[model samples]
Target chain A: MKEIYLDNNATTKVDEAVFEEMRPYFCELYGNPSSMHFFGGQVQGKVSEARNRVAALLGASPEEIIFTACGTESDNAAIRSALEVFPERRHVITSRVEHPAVLTQCRNLTQKGYRVTEIGVDGAGRLDMEEYRKAIDDDTAIVSFMWANNETGVIFPVEEAAAIAKTKGALFHSDAVQAIGKIPINMDGSAIDMLSLSGHKLHAPKGIGVLYLRRGTPFRPFLVGGHQERSRRAGTENAAAIIALGKACELAGQHMEAENTIVKAQRDRLQDALMVAIPNARINGGGAERLPNTTSIAFEFVEGEAILLLLSELGICASSGSACTSGSLEPSHVLRAMGVPFTCAHGSIRFSLSRFTTDTEIDTVIREMPAIIARLRQMSPFGREFLKGQA
Target chain B: MWDYTPIVKDHFLNPRNVGDIPDADAVGEVGSLACGDALKLYLKLDDNKDKILDAKFQTFGCASAIASSSALTEMVKGKTMDEALAISNQDIADFLGGLPEEKMHCSVMGQEALEVAIFKYRGMDIPEHDSEHDHGHAYPDHEGTIVCKCFGITDTFLKKVIETNRLTTAEQVTHFTKAGGACGGCIPKIQELIAQVLGDADVQPRTRPEKLSNMKKMQLIQEVLERDVRPLLWADGGDLELIDIDGSRVQVAFRKACAGCASSGNTARMVEVKLRDLVAEDIVVEEVSA
Candidate 1:
């Protein structure tokens, strides 16, 4: 069976170019970037070049970029460093639809004594700017929000939010893990103080991320150890993955146009086919501005896990925001925060496309999905009633 | 992904009886859309009305849930109503080569559906028993004292699972019964139940406190804060001053460094729960603006 990989928002397959660029770092250039020896010093030069490439992709300076393990670490480093820099600030502001990295961390902060104000989102998954504006006060140390939601693919007004946070004298951060490769971002003109990006979300191998900290921002290191990342992040560098990330960022910069055009067209084709073929199927965040390469469709009355399992049997890989898929008793927090009806929320499936996704793969999914949903709906009690009503 | 057994995967992929039985002798439904899984069981009885001629199920859930329902319908087929009613959740799980610990509720739902089906067949009200059948005694139903607010697991239900599973630890209880799986506010109660079931003679039975008036509750909260909480806060260069008490809501202000401390919410919750434990078991403490 030919595999059709569509779950790119979860993680993408490493680009061949990135893999090739990283190969030498693993074998021939296997020198610690921190060592003072000639071989190691030569490797350190490549690491710096990699940082410059990554910085160039984000329109940030090399000095502003700090490489971490992954997006979660970058998010943690940004939020924790901000709080540490301002010990007197008692409050933090964030959106209710943040990834677990930010949401769970913010919730954990409340237990430690920090006041947290979670701004709500509208039915289409757009943030309530008025509530967000009110939430940021003198006590707030940082305002952390996502650039694009992973599940819904809803793009937030991060630049505007950051500008608002600036007036309140709070550090602003955006977890742009999902938005980095799919959309254009220029940090040179944006008010966002810190931004996070994961390598794997683009085409790089996992375990590599970049935290873009605006130069001259009040600084505190989350990890205090080695003289690495200019002492901003402490640890021996993941040289090979870092090199891979640099190549991936360069590829992302080149492919950004294709991502918004060709890949987005394929996503729309699949979305249109699924919506037309399946009954009561609606896009989760269709009303809001979303990433071009992603679509979250909710097939009401039929469960997502069952649909996903059936899709898996056909060699098609996708993801769901359903409770069962997440191993949680509740559906995705993003869906819940947007007030998605329980009928639809439990059946939401997220199909994210990458540069590798082909038109044939999208066609295969469109051809097979309706039959899968029909089979499951026939067995579903609520779905049977819905079908009967339709009849 | 869950390590689902091949049998479970097979059953879910190809459910045995997937449809509602029209003109069925009895029908039973359990769970709701909000709960994320639900099952409706239909039984077609023989002329004698005691033997189940056929069984069908319609389920809305994950793989384990669907497999459990499918396995249930297959298990109950051709069995008498009494025998069908005797089949436990363990039997459903065993048939499917065992379900994941967290997905045990799916099997439990199957058993509940069977019990309800039997009740419907006999035209009897479904007994408010702990669903898990082992001791064979139907304990008095007390839905008021809900221990695990996350799953709505009552005190009686907690004791029943503890007694049936012979569970000694709170972790095991959470595994078999998802009582403290969410929010975990009821974990202490679950631990107390485990101790009680394990025959720890030192542990006394918890008695329900009588509802206090607003004035009396406020007075107790202030007294407790001054006597117990204030000393701990003062020791940490922090002070807790009670501002107002509106019913169960106890509003207090943190002074000094404690106000800006990251762990203040935990401190506030600790104070709230402590006052609730001492005063009324429903006290909510909030950090009020000074």
Candidate 2:
């Protein structure tokens, strides 16, 4: 059965070009980049070339990028370094809708007597700039906000939020895991002191990530031992995945236009038709500036996990912010922080597209979504009541 | 991702009796939209009004929930009211080859709706339940001090679920009733309730008794075994009978499912640990033949 995978925000399929690019590095070009030998030197050059490719995608210099194991590590390394560099500061600020990688870390800091201020979001999942601005103080070590939420795809104005943190002499970081490939980013002349991104989110294989630390930002190593990543990160290089990420980054730069145009059109088409065909359905972050290839639709009086299971039966894969799917007794923290009503929050399904997403896939989802919602709604007590009123 | 049984998937994909009976003789609605699942069960009685002629449901929840509801309707179609009222949540899950532990509450919801339908049909006075929060605990028409504030679960409701499902751990309580699944502020309370249901009358639950004579320790160990340990094992279709008590070592013989069980060593160790925790610090449990 052909799988109609629409859960790109969770992780993307590894691009074939990227897979081929890293295939030879495993057994063929298998040499330690740090070893002082001719074979090692050849591998070292290729590693540097990969770094250059990754840097080119972010409009950054090669030296600014520190490779890590995954996006979570990059986020941890960036935040921990900021706090270590400014040990006197005892406050960390992050938005409430950040992925658990950053949110959990920030929350843990509170146990060590560091004050954490989680900036709230509006019902549309837009960050509250005023709360964020007021939260920044001279004691603030860093302000970390997500560039685009993984669940809702709502984009935050990190540049503006970063500028506010700088006024208080605090470092600013952005977890751009969802934004890097789907949208354009330029580190040059930007106020963001650090940014973290994941490889697998952009068609690269997992287990490779980058933390772009601007030049002149005070740095402390999160992992320390080997001189790998210029001693900023420790251990041996993930040469194969690192090389794959480099090629993926290059392809992402090449596909940015199509991502913003064709993929965006597909996302729009899906959401527009869903809103039209399914009554009482609305997008989660419809009013906000969102990622080009994402839409979260909440069908009232139905549960998201039920919709997803029905969708799954048809070879369609998606994700939900409902309480059941999250393994929690409540809906997603992102949805709750947005103050979304219980009616819609329980039924919210996120559909994220990619450059690889075909129009037929979107068409398939659009054609099947209304019926799925109708089926579930028909079985819902609230839905039956609504139908009775309609009758 | 739920590791659902094939039966569960089949029922979820092609749910049975997915509608309401317009002129039904009995109707029971449990759960709420805020709880992330709700079910309205309808039952049509035979002309004598004793046997269930038809059963239907309208459910809003995940796959397990819909499947559980569907299974409940199918299971009750031919049963009399007395037979239907005796149906347990575990029975619904059993009909579907069992549900994931985390989703046991879905089966519980199905069972609650059946009881509510029968109770309302008998004209039992069930107060209107608050649906603003996560759980509709009052659906069973029982009230008590709220225990799990996050899920809006009450002590009476939780204790009944704990007793009926034979829930051993606080985690199991959460899985079966969603009582302490959020914030976890009420886990200690849930544990206390579980101990209470298990007949653990010791003042300090799970604390080793202090200053007991060697003979007194033996009696206390037996009491703890009879009170707490045996019931927990029996809940799992297993049993152990006390064979002998030597100063610090206690001997027991397995019965039923506990007999010839490969993991009975772990079970014996669990009994030893429970005894040590509740009776005396040096208590030991050894399994022996009858």
Q: Pick the candidate with the highest lDDT.
A: 2
Off by over 4 Å in 1: B127-162, B167-290
Model 2 per-residue lDDT tens digits across residues A1-391? 7999999999999999999999988889999989999988888888899999999999999999999999999999999999999999999999999999999999999999999999999989999998887789999999999999999999999999999988999999999999999999999999999999999999999899999999999999999988898899999998889889999999999999999999999999999989888889888989999999889888899998888988988999999999888678788999889888887789999998888889899889989988999888888888988878888
Q: Tens-digit lDDT track for model 1 on A330-349?
A: 78889889998877788999
- List the pairs of residues colliding in candidate 2: none
Place model 1 in a CAPRI quality band.
acceptable
Docking class of 2: medium
- Quick one: best TM-score, which candidate? 2
RMSD of 2: 6.5
Per-residue lDDT tens digits for candidate 1, residues B1-290, read: 78798999999988999898899998887665655667889999999999999999998888888999999999999999999987877678778867776677778778878877778678776444332232111122234477776555677767766665455677767655556765678888899888777675336633335877777777777767865676566446576668887777888988765887899999998897778777888777889878
Native-referenced Cα lDDT, model 2: 0.89
